[model samples]
Target: MEKTREWVITGADGLDDLLVDELLALGGSEPRRLKGAIAVQGDLAAGYRFCLWSRLASRVLMPLLTVPSGNPDRMFDDALKYPWEQVLRPGATFVIRSAAAKGVSTHTHFAALRLKDAIVDRFRQRTGDRPSIDTENPDLSLHLFIEAQQLTISLDFSGDSLHKRGYRLAQTDAPLKENLASAMLMQAGWPARGEGRLFDPLCGSGTVLIEAALMWADAAPGLPRIHFGFDGWAGHQAELWKTIRDDAVARRLAGLQRPAPRLVGFDADGEALACAHRNAESAGVSQWITLSQRSIAEWRAPALNSVAACLPAEWAADVTGAGQNYSVPGLVATNPPYGERLGDEGSVRYLYRAIGRQLRETLPCWDAVVLAADITHADALGLEHKHTLRLYNGALPIFARHGRILPAEPELPLAFEGSLDDLPEEGMDFANRLQKNLKVSLKLAQQQDVRCFRLYDADLQEYNIAIDVYEGRLQVQEYAPPKTVDPAKAEARFKLALQIIRKVMGLHRDKVFLKVRERQSGKQQYEKQGKAGKFFEVREGQATLLVNLTDYLDTGLFLDHRPMRLRIAAEAAGKHFLNLFAYTGTVSVHAALGDGIHGGAETTTTVDMSATYLGWADRNLALNGLPDSHHRLIQADVMAWLKDERDLYDLIFVDPPTFSNSKRMDSDFDVQRDHGHLLRLSMSRLAPGGTLYFSNNFRKFVLDEALQAKFDVTDISAETIGFDYERDPKIHRCWRFRHRV
Candidate 1:
């Protein structure tokens, strides 16, 4: 019997226990777990078996010696004491990799350089030949590490981290590492206890399915490798390794004689599926696996009677055990992209919810495991899990857990009523209206050089949604239905309408922002719906405005009032401008910067109640190259500011919400009830022959007859409405009021 050799196997953090189990199963003894590595005693054949069978380990290192190290000088002397010519031939190329804890050897690159110097000097003295360093591919790969002033040197037996697997010739957008996929499969109990079936719905590059196929065929992951780091070492025994590999080949041939496990992969991206086929072919497991192109929502479990119908005729075998009467559902394992790497959190949540519902309805008996980068993302799946296996993929921390797919109970049914394959009636009507409206609005926008406008404004009552286009991005707002409407039906209609809009407009998932518009009271209008704080620039006439689509219910720029801002810009020149209830100060920015305002306005003052809106106004003003000395921002109640103002303005723009009860205000203000008092106070500060453009979004707003009698009032609401918004006459009401001189 051969003597046992001490070995250390290193892998990603948090999978130490799994690595230990893998080593112990391959005839290793006295297996011990370290922080992120494992130590075991095994013979030469045992070591060779681990190098060939390990799927989770990154590298297998054979420690030659340990030396006490302090500074660079001592480390160099210690490295030179080891025999280098024996490990490598006279002219064989080599490379030294280094890692150090925060101590005397702080820099990894400097340590690596010192080790190389010592090895090269020793080789020159012994054989009179200095070995050349090959960074890309080396005959001998040396690993050097220093921790707590102790340095240990080892020879890397399995080069390139052992995770490459050498079969993945192509990659998708964010492909998972092969080893991490294998770890997930092991945690799910694949090929152990007669594992039957395997599936990956979102398989990109087919890493998970390919790894499972290898395990099912009883083939080693490294069987296809033509070279390893130990090939050139003098201590390597060639015949011992050949025996181990020959045994693996014979086991693989024997496993092939029996029925192959049903391994399948599906991806919505056809290119990804094609890549999976190429990868499976390279891995020599193409015959045992099947690939298809379909979305997650479209996936359905195979019928129990014909479970293996999708596979080739020669590979189709009984999906059930010999004594079992029915076929069992396969294990589902997938590594779906997280929010940070793929799309937004909301989209990923929607995807996970769809996946969970599909699993519950179709494959309730199947065991599932999903690997997610975030705990929040995993919770979005809406499935209960037994436990999570925490692991690391490169630098990203991940959670791999067993997911429970419960059967749909008769008492409690799923919320989804219909499939999302096509648009419903309400959605179809909404899409047609948007297409018709966009044709005219787009032409009008191009003629006027406008980059933002309303494309659809609740044309279909059943789908109470408004679609606005800013540049190429779309912002959709769904109006809260009345109490008479069904909540579930309303949600279904809203989702379908959004789908239609996205398809018709060719918008990516991230390009469309959705919000719900409800009757807001108090500070609800100013509250944030999301914290993304994403802003995009849109052009209205000459000035640019920054509008946030994801943060709040209402974007900073109101599309219906685009014409009014342009009108204000056209009329103001060499005049003092006042914008009360300024919101984002879009009109002020236009007035201060537009070319129509010759010599520009002397100075502009913008007043709003919310500090957030005030800050947004400041950014808008700065975006258009407007000087602060020429533009001012004030956080105050518009009514109170009107009372204290002593100076008269040449032009004024007042556009207030329908209702507000802000904490900063002395009392709640209603536009319908307070218009009389608001107009009376605002006209007092108006200069002689000055015009005040008053606009309100209240659909039922009525001008006070008493105030109209006192001031020169012209209902120019018709003139303010642009061609795009003419369909909704009551979108906003505007009037030009001046003191009767």
Candidate 2:
């Protein structure tokens, strides 16, 4: 029998024309763009070529036959009439996938089911056995497209969605699907050859970077992928596929230009940076790219002379590579957070303004491209737009704006004033007066830049102790008595001092409710009821961090751990990470979506003891889109599971509560006493040459001197405390331990 071969490239609706152009570039003949597909007349070799090089197409479909039908029954009958024997063996596994537009059948599933029955019935009638359906994975995949009364059934040549490039072992929140990212880059007019730098400042998961790199290198994005749909198809052409891949490799190797544009990404989150680096390495482009953990405010444009200096070094090291570096000026591009994903509308607006201001101030000469949700926000950039193009990103309308930096605007003034002591004490009662006096003393310490300083009167009528951190130092003090204090008031003041000494140092907030509890009674006295009262109240100049003492047990801020969270978020983008005892999954969420690189197993998995905490993790994941199938959430004891689970993780966070008791685990754990055991268990699950971040809020915690023999621990407690912990910065102790391979 003579066979007819045709190439069909599937793309996002409204992008078939672009796919046609891409197919034509890959040597397809007579390409025609349909409503949702691009058809090209090609031999088997052309099919292979299209698959390897067409970045815009979702997948390449090879048509066996196009049967015409108006209704479900006729569609099924037409499907059965095809020469099934030629396409599949009697006992082979297969699956049918269908898509229906408005004018077509309203129920896509029913249409798909009918087609499935027809295929089975036809095969059954002929050979007394039918091919089995394997939806998860199938030997052969059949694709059906229905529009209006027109139905088109074809063979799925690419198999799975082309975006599953196989390099990703894990995924972070709200990952941009691969095809969508490629489409976005293509739409942005990113040049294949450039000395221009490509920057994704908010490079969550490194999707944009990897996609751009692949395009620049002219490398087939699917080369590293282990499987392709065509490999399992009945009309599979191994020789053609090899030729196509070999040709692509040859082009990539030959087209490898010297002095490729400097590709860099930066984020304020450490976990994001780590993830980006890992992803770039996996993609085989780490050497060509740079990833940094830096706030957007810290980013400075490279000097032209600095770039020229690199040219000489490059020429000395590799003259051939030097020639490749001169293609074009650098380009800075990123998809900043929109209200739907990262923050509320006001916060997102602020973030956008920050982005606009930073780019305008720092990268005056660099070309800029930004993907934003609407024209209004794009206008907020305040840069004269060279061009604006509309595109749909996951159903939301987005405008990709290209422009140069505008004239700089004056910097905004600081929002808060001087330290707590400066607060007025007029009209306060005795206790309030004492509190005001302590606030003033703390302010004085801050002004002096004392790392640790304290102020309190020993004989204050009601309370007499205050602790504060000045310039990162810790200070404690007993308040001196005011003149003429009564004996009863003195006794009360003395009791308050004893309570502070005994209980204040050991206070632990309830993870589930964010409540403060008495260590001895195990009862929560202050509970956080909702978000309204649960914010960390900052009186800015007076103190970097302050809590609403009456509304929530513990302030919404963990001042001491602020620096650590910032560090984790900076390094999070591309690394596979594990966060144990994850309260609210804040660190995990930050790392999964912060920036730098995009897309990889540097996806973070969080495990905690309480389902309540896990539920909070779920909300955090949804809040960030880091909770896809690739992200794992386990409600279990980190210690117990570390022993049982053998899966190795790249980064492990082991911040256990100071103490815990659960009937579920049949044990009560105290971090101060059990940290050694906890650290060991966590280290057991660490990948060779992996890092474990261990921290505890037990102020009096003494490291087990004996555990030093097994692990090398670097105390980072001082470095991890942020300015917010102005009062007693050493709120917790932290260490980074790496297993000696």
Candidate 3:
């Protein structure tokens, strides 16, 4: 009988199509989409080739046999009867993993353990010595999928999940999975070949940019991975794997275009930038990227012509391949911060508003694709939305807003012709101060050449304010009242306020749009409302840090941590970093990129208890170039992992919540009460002389008296926090620790 081989590729949610297309492009048979998976028919050699080259696949499994069984014992018996000698060598290390969908089995682990016993018994009965189970790093991996009593046992031809594309050496909190990163880049419509800059403004570990560099160079995303299940399979084809690798290498060499466009990342954290640079180095593309440590406000685009001139000759040829001059236009793409799981509603809104402002002002001609949950935020950019593609970063439904800046609208006279006394007696002072603040902010933004600035006064009553700053213009409006008697009336009142501000500044009425939203009770309530509001009015040329202060506790910016995220991406090349208490894992993604010169591929691991936050972290990782294999997301308590696992990491981020009950670990974690213990435990897992970044948002968190005795601790809070944090300068405290031992 002719041998028939089947392969499966796993991916993030909604990525089955990309994986299928990738497989077909590689000459595999038509791929069939399954839940979170893609199946294809090919020869063993083709399967191995797929394992080695696929970028969007998480794992490539080769089915060895399928058996029908009604019970666990029968399933084991059928699995044991397989030709074990053909697949497993005597005394080799192996592991069994099982997944049971509905109608198949209820206990997945139990099913997996049974299969393991069967495989071992088969080996032992024949050879008297059995392959030992090596779960962490198995020589051979077997995957069993049971669906409705139909058992499918396959050898994980891609060994470690295809997501682990061997380039990463360190990790941080909630890093993006490698495959998901690739998928996200694909979804973002990242140009396959372009000299235009690809940026991850909130790059946690440099996953998005690194992936873009790799894809841009036609480098196989899995080139750095060391092992594959095909390496040990009975029909393993070393020659084919070699051919695939060699072909990939040859393509990379031939595709080497000169003066690649600046693949840049910005994060505020120095450690994160260091890690990103290190990661880029590991990925072997550090030379193709640029890393910067600056807040979004400080970020300056490279000269347009300079960036355009950096395009390789070949890219010009390829663009001309379609008979068009290859003048690669600059494009700004990023996974901006959202309030979900990463920051409070206030911080997320502030972040979105800031991003909108930056795109509108500094990158007017440049195209931008922003992956955000609330698509309405795109209106804040003062740009016309050309298209919006729907995608899910895990379960968070997001819209990829793609557009270029629209021409400036003609100015109109203020709609209101009334004096301050015309306003309600209760709101007269608030309105006057708000108008004054808007004027001051607009002037400051223009003076600083800020394309988009925010003017907000959270403390103001009746007229809490937010303004959008644009070139030669300002858009001012009142935040929605805390509890509105009539939202329509309140909105009208806000419009009047805007007109008053416009008239005061002698600006056109078309330059400003007033927005009002009723404040809700809690964070979830606010998120629902924010999502419901779709788009809020964006003030042009406002100088404050946040655009929408009253939408939630946080406006659209987290100005304080902007520097930290930028720094992490700058330095994350070719290093493995860990992010603990990675709320949204923004820093972890930044550190995955090496310094752009070498385009490093660092690995990152993000840990958090909230699945909601982890989902956001995963999206951040995907938005960057980090692959699933290069990053790990653990929905477990950090303290428990410190106690249970002995894995040593190069960079460790220990940013813990102030206090919380962690249902995942079944314990109450108080950073103040237990930070010393937590820090000690995390440090114990750090690689020798590795750096441990410990931070807490608690303003009152006191350092443990004993911590200084064992390690070097430096207070980096001042450097890490940017200019936006107001209430208490010490809202969060960060310390860098280096092990003495």
lDDT of 2 by residue, 1-741 (tens): 223367888776656556677777777878776766778887777777766666777788887656555677777778788778777755678888988765554777887898889888888888888789999878888888877747778888888777766555444556666666676666556765234457777776677787788777777877776666777666676766887788878877764564575677766566666777778778777777767654443343332124421221221111122214322245667776665665334334435665776566555444567777767778777665677666566677777777755546553321112222322242124334444544564465356332232333233435554443322222333345555778677566555443343232222222112121224311131224345533221222111222333343333234456567656766655677898878656667656654322322357788876664555455445433332444677878777888789888877788877766666565777787788888878888888877788889888899888667778778888887654344455678888888765
State the lDDT of candidate 1 residue by residue for 198-236, as single tens digits.
778778889999998888888888888888888867778
Residue range with the least summed lDDT across 10 consecutive positions in model 2: 311-320
lDDT of 2 at 433: 43
TM-score for each candidate, following the candidate numbering:
0.57, 0.53, 0.56
Q: How many angstroms is residue 422 displaced in model 1 relative to the true structure, after the best TM-score fit?
A: 48
* Each prediction's whole-model lDDT (CA): 0.78, 0.62, 0.63
- Could you tell me the lDDT of residue 631 within candidate 2? 61
- For candidate 3, the C-alpha RMSD (Å) to the true structure equals 14.1
* Pairs of colliding residues, candidate 1: none
Error of 2 at 420 (Å): 43
Candidate 1 ranges beyond 4 A from true positions: 102-105, 193-195, 300-328, 411-741
